[model samples]
Structures are given as structure tokens and as C-alpha cells.
Target: MRLAPVSLSLVESVLAKPVLDEKGMILVGAGVKLSERMITRLKQLGVSSLYIEDKRTDDIVIVDAVSDETRRSAVNTVYNSMLSMIETERGARRASRPQIGREISRVFQDILADLKANNSGLINLASIFTVDGYLYHHSVNVAILSTALGLAKGYGQKEITEIGVGALLHDIGCTKVPQEILNKPGRYSDLEYELMKKHAEWGYEMLREQDGVSLLSAHIAYQHHERNDGSGYPRGLKGDEIHEYSKIVGMCDVYEALTSKRFHREAFLPHEALEFILGGGTALFDLSLVRLFAKNVAVYPIGMTVKLNTDETAVVVSLNPEYPQRPVVRLLTDEYGRRLDSPYDIDLTKELTMMIVSYNE
Candidate 1:
């Protein structure tokens, strides 16, 4: 199967992966052949891409770093926790804040276990989701990405759990912000922007009051926006003033936000998002964390199409864990744009002369 943009062309194609809801339930299951109506609905739901069945790439498989069960549980946990917090704030019901913290921590352990058992040692968060589910999915993605970075840095289990929990709840403060501002499709006015920026302090206050949440973890919510050069919000902490855990989560948060399709703009491809992160190294974010992120993330995810500098087109077959920028690709077309009768695979790390020029063809 291969990843393709959602369009009329997918009318007769079968879905290779399931499209999930905010609750982590499968809205459309795999192996379901799509109709024009289904495709139209997907586009309306803000789905920009889909993994469709293709005999040519039948052997290609895209693996998630975490298991399906774990992912479902994580999303559900985040959704419930955030909703409960929001309701509590509105005086709708009394919520056990400590219990919320404990529940999130438990789910983080499951996510950590899955990441450790994953042999690929690379992160792929190209899951299909609806726009309404963005916050729930984004929380889980950030946690997974941050945990991957922690493992790459050789952090112990305790440290990993701390950072993982912190990452999972980094945006908890946003629950306090008005729904209009949070879901605004365009730029924010100055007053709206100021209100938005207060989420960090709000989140810190909430998390710090939870019995199960650590002070260090609460600080992650507080300082995740703090820049390495003292340009970030809430506090102008520079250099070593920002906690290392916050630095890790901050980078992952930016990368996840960029790669996700939004109301205002199309999602940036993995490679394009990486360039943005690289460009901000040492200025907007910690340089060391940015380098660590670029190393572990799959710039060109499996089953993604690319046009090589050789004027050939190929599908990424697998990741070269040590060099994510260079993946193993299976050629699909020659320079002349003719389909090849016999497609062949090449490892970009070995073929140094060839490079990917464009993707999503």
C-alpha cells in the first residue's frame, strides 16, 4: 500500500489503514473500498492523505512505534482527562485532579514500554485523523516523539517517564482558553494573543496542584515555550535556565504542529518541517535537541513517494535508522516518466550520488 492524497482519484481504491476518530475508535476500517462519497467526506473532515491498497507495493508495511491498543488507550486517556478538566473549570462537575494525573502517568508507562520494544528505533506519526481530534492526537504524538528523543539520549526509565508524562500534558493549559481562540482559523488579535499566551502559567498552576504530578513535570508545561535564546513566552529564560525536559518537549511540539494539517494551512511534509526545525536551531529551540529530533524522525515515512535527482520516482521502503534523511526506496518510474515493468530497490546511504528532490508525487 502507498500514501496518496485524498481526491476523486481514490474513489475506487481500498483503504490500507483505518481512519480513526478522536475517541480512538475506527470510523472506517481497513480493506474498505472507498467510493466518491467516502472520499468527499474524508476531505470535508480535513483528511489530506490516505494509505491506499496497491499491488505493486503490497510488501511495503508502515509500522507505528506504539501498538494499536496502546495508541487507542493513550488517545482516550488524553481526551477524557482534558474534557474532565474543562468541565471542572466550568463548574459542571467535580473532578479528581490527582486521579487525572495518575491515569495519565499510567498510560505513559504503556507508551514507554511499546517504544522500548519497537525495533525500528524511528518515530512515525502519520496517522489519519479528523480535525476535531487534533488536540487528542497531538498530545499522544508529542509524548511519543519526546520519549523517542529521551531514549536516543540514553536516559533511564525514571527520567523517560517524567519527560513522557510532561510531554503528554504539556498543552493541558489550553483547556482553559476560550474555544473560539483555540480553534481560530486565522491569526490572533493582540488581546487574543495575550490570552493565548497565558495558557502556560495556567497549566503550571493546574499541574502543580495535582497530587500525582511532579513539580518538574509541571515545569515542563510552564517552560516548554521558553526559547534557548530567551525569546520564548511567560519567562525569558535563556541558555541553561530552561529545563532539559522542557527543551525536548518544546522541539517535539513544534515538529508535531507543523506536520499536522490545520485550519489555516496545509501540513508541511516531514522533510519540510525538519528544515524549519533546523533553521531555528539555537535561536528558537535548543540546538542539541533539534539535532536529536532530526536524527530519530523518519523524514520520508515508509510508503511515501519521492522524485529522485536522477529524474526517477520511487517509494520509500524502509528507514535507515542512523541516517533518517537517506531511506531505502523502491523505484517505480524511470526519468522519462514511463512505468517500469520491474521495480527495483536502492538504499540511499549506499547510493550517495542519488538524492530525493521532491515528494508527494
Candidate 2:
């Protein structure tokens, strides 16, 4: 299946994957042919892209970082947990641990098992979510990613668990803010920005008192925004002052937020987000953690089309760690604009002169 922008015209092609709502419910099932009415409804609902069956890319299969069941369960667990937190009265902030705590713990365990099993492959991090569906999916992706990076950095099971929990709840403090401020379409004003920035400390205060929640986990919420150079928020601590867990989670947190679509701007693609990280260097994020993230993430995920410096249109078939910017691609059309009779593969690592010029999302 090919991942491409869908419009009202492609009503005849069969859906390669199911279109799901924010709550993990199906909007359109896989193998269902779309109609004009269906396309119009999807567009109205803010669906910009769809996985459509294409004969040219039939053999290409895109793998998720975790299984669909795992992904859905993780999202629901987060949504439910946050919902309960939001519904609580202001004075009762230290109420009993909502059901989401136990539920998300189980979800993290399941994620660890899946990651260990499929550790060999590149992390596929694409998520289907509308702009308003933040926090739930973002939390899940950050958890899985930070855990993977922690493992690659030689962290043990105990350390990884702490990191996973910390990563998942790092943004739990966002619930403390008004939904209007959180979901506003424009950039935050000075006063609104200050209020929004307080989420980290607020989240820390809430989690620190919860049963079964560790000090490190609570601190993750507090310190994930704190930078190595003491340039971060709340209590800015430099170098060793920032915990290793926060370092990992903080790096992943920024990556997920940048790559994720938002109300104000189109998401920076994975490669673009990584480039932003590199530009920051160790001033804003830890250098070691950045290197670990670079090692694990795929810049251009499989099954996405791209254009090369040679002016050929191709689909990413595989990733190469040695050369992330130069992936193995299956050419759709030659430089001369003629479609190939039999599509051929090119390893950009070998074709030293060629590089991906544009991402065709």
C-alpha cells in the first residue's frame, strides 16, 4: 500500500488500512472501497491522508513500532487516565490513583515485550491522529521511543521501567490547564505560555504522592523540560544535575512533539525534527541521548514516497543505519519522467552521488 494524500477523486481505490477515530474506533474498515460521500466526510473530519492499495507497491509492508492492539490499548489507557484527572475537583488534586495508573503500567509491560522481540528493525513512528487528539497518542509514542532509546543506551530492566513510566506521564500536567488554552489554534501569549509551562511542576506534584509511583518517575515529569545547560524551565539544572531518565524522556518528548501534527503548523517530518535536534547540539539536549535517538529512529519511514537528487520518484523500501539520509528506494519513475516497466531498487549508500531531495508525503 502507498501512503499518499487522498482527495475526493480516488473513490475507486480500496483502502489499504482502516481509518480509525481518536478513540480507537474504526471509521472505515480495511478493504472497503471509498465513495465520493465517504471522501467528503473524511475530509470534513480532518483526514488528509489514507493508505491506498497501489499495484506498484503491493509487496511493500510497513511495520509499526508496536502492534495495533498494543498501540490502541496504550492510547485508551492514557485517554481514560487523563479524562479522570481532568474531571477531578481542584482541591482534590491528590485524589486516589485513577484506574489509568494500573492500566498504563500493564500497557508499558506489553510495550517492553514487543520492543524486545522486534528490536532488530527500525522504529516506525507514524501515528494517525487529528490535531485535537494530542496527549494520548503523543504520550504512547514517547513511552515506546524513550524505552527503546534507554535500552539501546545499556539501561537495565529496572531503569527502563522507570524511564517508560516517566516518559508516559511526562505531560500529565497538561490536564491541569484549561482545555481552551491547551487546544488553542494560535501560538501562546506570554501569560498563557507561562501558565502552560507550569505543567511540568504540577504534574510532578500530583504524581509524587500517588501510590506505587516512584520519586524518579515523578521527577521525570518535573525535569524532562530541564536542559543540560540549565537553559530549561522550572528549576534549571546543568549537566549532572539533570537525571539520566529525564535526559532520555526529554529528548524523545521533543522529537514526538515536533514530528506530530499540531493545530498551528504542519509537523516537521522525522528527518526534519532530527535536524532541529542536531542544530541545538548539547545546549538544549544531551549529546549522548541525541546520538542514541539517531541510532534508533528511521528518518523516512518505509512505504513513503520521496524524490531523489537525480530527480527520480521512489518509495522508501528499507532503512540503512550507516547512511540514514540515503535509504534503499524502489524507483517509481526515472529521471526522464517515464514509469519503469519493472521497478528497480537503488541503494543510495552505493549510489554516492544521489540523495533524497524531497519528502513526498
Given candidate 2, what's the lDDT at residue 349? 90
TM-score of 1: 0.95
What digit string (tens of lDDT, one per residue) describes model 2 on residues 61-136?
Answer: 8778888788777877777777776666355655767455667678899888888887546688655655466677
The TM-score leader among the candidates is: 1
Clashing pairs in model 2, backbone N/Cα/C closer than 3 A: none
Best by lDDT: 1
In model 1, state the lDDT of residue 134.
Answer: 86
lDDT (Cα, 0-100) at 53 in candidate 2: 82
| Residue 353 in candidate 1, Cα distance off native in Å | 3.8
Q: List TM-scores for all candidates, in order.
A: 0.95, 0.93
lDDT of 1 by residue, 60-170 (tens): 988887888899899999999888888777885444478888999999999999998988767887578887788889989999999999999999978998899889899
